[model samples]
Target: MDISDKATEREEQDRDIALHQRKPEGPAATGQCLYCEDPLPPGKRWCCTACRDDWEFIQK
Candidate 1:
């Protein structure tokens, strides 16, 4: 299309990429502990060190 349309499309693509990159990956993204499946506090990935250790073990 036009140059203006190309610029808008590029902006939209950049926004989508940023949003995707900011999203958490793996079980942590679901707001539960990666191992125990317990509810997590805001910005927490695991409920405790045990769960965190379990996740680390599984990843290896």
Candidate 2:
């Protein structure tokens, strides 16, 4: 393809990557893990990284 077309394709790819990496909005923490309902400290959504990753996976 032409240089301009290639540039446009790259831009679209970058946009796609950014969108995929963006986190989806979730409910506010309520003193529990969003995934496992385990107790959590204030301002925390997940009990651990594994829980967070699983939660995000299920969200998709």
Candidate 3:
């Protein structure tokens, strides 16, 4: 494609990415695992990565 067409395509791609991006929901630090309710320190959302993944999966 020509320079103008390529520029338009890039703009469209950027807009698509911006539209799909999402901000984190809920509290930043709940002091417990969101999925399993396991105890955790402050500033932690999940006890482990697995719990975090499961929480997100269930949310979807």
Specify the highest-TM-score model's number: 2
TM-score leaderboard ranking: 2, 3, 1
Q: Is candidate 1 or candidate 3 better by TM-score?
A: 3
- Worst 10-residue stretch by lDDT in candidate 1? 21-30
What is model 2's C-alpha RMSD? 6.8
Q: Please give, for residues 1-60, the per-residue lDDT of candidate 1 as tens digits.
A: 499999999999999989966845554446788788898776677888888888988988
lDDT-based ranking: 2, 3, 1
The most accurate candidate by lDDT is 2
For residues 1-60, write the lDDT of model 2, one tens digit per residue: 499999999999999999966668878878999999999999788999999999989999
Q: Write the per-residue lDDT of candidate 3 for residues 4-56, one digit (tens) a residue.
A: 99999999999998875544575566788888999999878889989889888
Q: What TM-score does model 3 achieve against the real structure?
A: 0.54
TM-score of every model?
0.49, 0.56, 0.54
RMSD of each: 6.8, 6.8, 6.3
User: What shift in Å separates residue 53 of candidate 2 from its native position after superposition?
Assistant: 0.4
Q: Report the Cα lDDT for residue 46, model 1.
A: 80
Error of 2 at 52 (Å): 0.4
Please identify which of the two predictions, 1 or 2, would achieve the higher TM-score against the true structure: 2
Better of 1 and 2 by lDDT: 2
The C-alpha lDDT values of all candidates are 0.80, 0.91, 0.83
